[model samples]
Target: MKKILLACSAGMSTSLLVAKMKEAAEKRGTEVEIWAVAQDKAPSEMKKADVLLIGPQMRFMKKKFAVVAEEVGIPLDVIDPVAYGRIDGEAVLNKAIELIGE
Candidate 1:
């Protein structure tokens, strides 16, 4: 299963989004592992992920994560504020697939 890892300031806010993404995946019958991680945990977590998405609030740190992502060989994208504000699970999932090509 493809793994999509999300990083936010504290991980709590994105938990709800993770739930929505899970539901969307379930509805589409997509077998993927999704989870949220605090920025502090990102370095360790990205190693296990196929793609990494950073919450809008954490966008400033994208460059930092980008380096780690490249080292880990995973595509990293910053979630659009609009999609994130709306909790657009399908859109985010599709974006992840588009980024990782899986």
Candidate 2:
């Protein structure tokens, strides 16, 4: 199963998106492990993730996350604000697949 980590300011708002993404993955018959974490905790969490997704609120952290992702040999991306605000699971799931080349 692919591992994905969602990073946000407090890890609260992204929890809902996490559920939506998981549901979308299930509907698409894809097996993945998804979790949400605070931005401050991302570095440690990245140790176990295959992909790192940052919420728009954490856009400033993208470069830092990219560096970490590169060092870990994983893909990193920022979620689309539209898809994120609307909790569009399908789009988010697609983004994940695209990032990991799955």
Model 1 weakest lDDT span, ten residues long: 93-102
Cα RMSDs, all models: 0.7, 0.8
TM-score of each: 0.97, 0.96
In terms of TM-score, the best-performing candidate is 1
- Please write out the lDDT profile of model 2 over residues 11-68, one tens digit for every residue: 9999999999999999989999999999999988998998889999899999988888
Which residue pairs clash within candidate 1?
none
Candidate 1 residue lDDT tens string, 1-102: 889999999999999888888889899899999999999999999999999999999999999999999999999999989989999998888898889896
Runs of candidate 2 with Cα error greater than 4 angstroms are none
lDDT of each: 0.93, 0.91
Model 2, residue 57: displacement in angstroms? 0.9
* Candidate 1 Cα deviation (angstroms), residue 87: 1.0
